[model samples]
Target chain A: MKVLEAETYQAGEVHRFEAAGQEFVYLAPAGGIFGISAAAAAVLETMGAAGRRMDELRAEMRAAGFSAGDVEEALEELIEARVLERPRTLPPPRQKMPERFPLQSLVMNLTNQCNLSCKYCYEYGEDKVATPDGKPKFMDWETAKASVDFFLQDSAGRERLHITFFGGETLMNFPLLKKVVDYAEAAAGAQGRAVDFSLTTNATLLTPAIIGFLADKRIGVTVSIDGPPDMNKLRVFANGRPSYDVIAPKIRELLARHRTRPVGARVTLTAEVTDCIRIFRHLTEDLGFQEVGFAPVTSSQKNLVTIGSGKMDSILEQFCALADEYLAAALENRQHAFSNVTDTIAELHEGVNKSHPCGAALGLVGVGPSGDIAPCHRFVDSDTHKLGNVFTGIDRSKQADFLERGHIDAKYDCHTCWARPLCAGGCHHEAYVRYGDTGHPNLHYCDWIRTWTDKCLRVYGAIAAQNPGFLEHFERRKAS
Target chain B: MKHLRAVNRKAVRVAGEIDAAAADVHALQEGAPPQPKPVPHYPVGCTIVFSPGWEVDSSGGTAGLCQPAERDLYDCYATCFWPAQVPDHLNNYPDWTKKCASATKDWREIDLVFP
Candidate 1:
């Protein structure tokens, strides 16, 4: 079944093919087959064998004293049956993956180096280790420039670009970080594009100067704070002292400086469900942060304990209960928004056809010190998802094929399931590191996404009932 | 007697010069009763005059004299009535009869009548 001829449309393409005993119509690009009646087919033949514009065909039938309405209905039936293909420009022939738009965030690790040595840190993880030298390294200015250039090329026509600085602590390499941001902003301006900046920091190195720079640049910040001092014991420095006292004051100062900008917290769940909820509440209610997100620490080789489905279920239940609390707080405050992972899940449920829900790994390219481009910051060391090197620039031709290989060979079982489109086969790096294959769907994350989706629909309904106009405005903003 | 004369007039006008092969193919394709030989009726210079109140039956399924034998009638009717429906006001004449009288004054005319 080769497509001998095809006409592309915005909705989908249509192709005419001869297979088995008869001629068949197929929706091209996606490749769904449709069945049209013999009478309708004869009418089509009379109009022209090659093809005619729909309106012209309709008029010709009408002038020839045929039922215009019947012909129109038959055309639609043919379309639905996959007998006719709608016309559309095909994706770039050379690329391995189709271009996906409206990317959510791009994660850029300013430097793989970090100050604190957390037990669960990827740098210290058995799978990915720093060089024998104890000193943390930084990304040079030239590589950073190339990274920005690569991003602009890959993300052409994307509505907004969010550059999220990550690392051991992105703030530790402040000079190179500033230079990268400056170059990106300048490049974006030259191309007439809009770019937003964000950072996920431990908040240990945040100072008055750092706060001022972030505030001036309008960078959204998410600080990592596990629980109170006791629960945060796992995230300690090389000297093995608690980091809470050091990070807390800096978080307060940065939040004070950028009151209007979004300042959120991320807490990693290492203990039981009860402890996780306690940590979440303490971070949001006690610390006065508007929003907080929770995630389990990645199961690196150093931490050989497998994350079981039982633990994952308990965490989801706790998170769902916490989401209810967060919603209540937002409503009570009348103007606060929490980093409800539910929103991202809800967008997925709404059938947004993104390659991945966590858009980090696709649109955003992370530059290793050696100038290799990993899919994103998280999978910097993994060979499976390493897109290409930035020095040669992005080979656009290989994108589609590369993505197809990743999708097919992904270890995440979810990739084969119907929900694959919504979850995007789960995190590739997480699957590769934990399970030795990217194709396996992380059931833990899948459960979390399902729970979050249900909670979001519930919250969204309540919000819509209270103010019908809110949804309208939100949808409008999404469209624009 | 009047109907026979009308039939003769039509037959005389269309007789002879008809392609025998085309007629044979037409007959074979129809696969029905054989058609009678056509007889030309009108002279070369005679004019056609449609009877007043002889309006075409536009309603479908009538099986009337003016109705077409094909599944569709609009195309046939449009072709048949083009000259008759040419408005008199456009030609500054009192009626279609008057328009035809003035218009064919300088040209030879042929009249067609169907029963």
Candidate 2:
């Protein structure tokens, strides 16, 4: 018996070895293994042509009564024997994107044009005045129909569609927006699908009429507001005017109009740490919103760029501390509350298996206007991570190739680390944009996970201590 | 009736053993005496022995040297006297007794239903 050991290879590096009278193939980063007997190698050359997912091959082998376990073991043996050529570094190839649960959410970019022109906006550039056509563009009826068609096909015309209106501000194309909603409602009624609509806006365009329409449709709203007016200093228009004051009143109006439906507020934190708690408290207590979350701006834009690594750490610490305080207050007051950081932590703790908690962005595909599909929304703009085009669907043969070549396949400290099962190497987009490679794990993420896990453990321990019979009580309640 | 016959056969086998082991073997050879076998062990709170063919006389039965009344079968192979307690002639072969004890421990207890 020959014992073959597991080996790690860098991206694009190729190594060859033979064992057990068979040739094997291995790819690093993506880490797929395949085996071919000496006699089968000749046939493999012909069969390995282009466009085959490993799943298809595995399925055929499974039908022949070769258990998946045995097939994988043989593949691993081939990998250890060095019969396969390991490629060192390859560009992200087109791999099959997992299409589970069908498509529930669709981001309809109403127009690439924005009113506030926030300094950290992804589309914000020095030549911000010009749209894609060198003029302000809006999604017309036909474009909206086409987008809806794409979504319906993926969803298999399923019920309960979640459509998100995105843009410089989706409200900029109010006429087209109304038309699309009307068309969607009619189409959904005919097809027996229930349509749920939501829009992410700056709130400056949220006039009384707009609020009435949104409230009438029972549409959920998430306004972009970064802390208080002063904290939102960086979020200004092209003329360098702060937009918080102008948007705050409109937000208040919408909140009053749509008090029943949940209103979510998003903040983009910069390096500023002054009065962070007060700002968060004002948003939570004074604004009376149901949920609040934040995403750091990517480092792509010129002005008001994302904070440096050191400052980013400080910012995250401050935000998390503020969130903890807010959550504690909400719990004490018995009020409805939501915090993304805490929610993510709770989810991690509640997961059944220690490994593979939530599906972060593994199978999720984000579609851009050009019909190109990226792994997630974060990498929509980065050409290197584009998996495939939705227009042609996914090219199965190229799926594995894309995954191997993608920046996400790069080496990260998280891969071999124990915390990997939880963090899953952090956000690939953040790693790529911030560290220049997707393979490298973010230390900030590690720090966050460690802090969150510690906090969760402490809370659970305290609860168990206070309520000694909590476990028995909970188990009994569940049993009945 | 068939079970009574089986029990009679077992009694005859015991009678032969008593003839070989007993000091008064010649008396039993002239006129056989009814030999009482030790009761078998059975689980608690259950009727183990049937009437007429077999009956339990004591709880532990024979000072723990013999099987308890609840036992289904009287495992004679497991019964061994202490070397100091038994006659020297019987203690001559220690290995044989040990093998008999192990064999008795391996025996299965089955319930025999009477017609």
> DockQ winner among the candidates?
1
What's chain A's TM-score in each predicted model? Answer: 0.71, 0.65
| CAPRI rating of model 2 | incorrect
Cα distance off (Å), candidate 1, residue B57: 26
Residue A459 lDDT, candidate 2, scale 0-100: 35
* Interface CA root-mean-square deviation for model 1: 28.7
**Model 2 segments beyond 4 Å from truth?**
A1-101, A125-136, A157-159, A188-191, A273-275, A300-304, A308-320, A323-333, A336-338, A352-374, A378-412, A416-422, A436-440, A460-480, B1-115
Instruction: Give TM per candidate.
Output: 0.60, 0.55
Chain B TM-score for the candidates in order = 0.17, 0.17
Mind giving the per-residue lDDT tens digits that candidate 2 earns over A1-480? 112223332212211223233343322222222333433242233224232334554555567666666655544333333333243354446334454446666766666667786766656553222224432256566657766666666676456777777776778888878887888888777888877888888887888999999999988888888877778887788799998888777877888888656788887766562344565676778776677776666553334565656765565566657655544543344332435544543432232212222232333455444545555554443466665665566454444443443323243354444344345556656556556655446665576565544443333233323332423423442232
Write candidate 1's Cα lDDT for A1-480 as tens digits. 111222221222333333223333333222222223454554456545355566666666667766755665555544433344444345324324545643345566677767787766666767553342432266778777777777787677775777888886888788988887888888888888878898889999988988999999988888887878887877888888879899888887887888757788887766342366777767767777777777676775346433456777777777677666655644454443346544542352233433543544455666565556666677664455566766786444444544553563343454333334445656666766667655455665665665555455455434433443434434543564
Model 1 chain B: lowest-lDDT 10 consecutive positions: B1-10
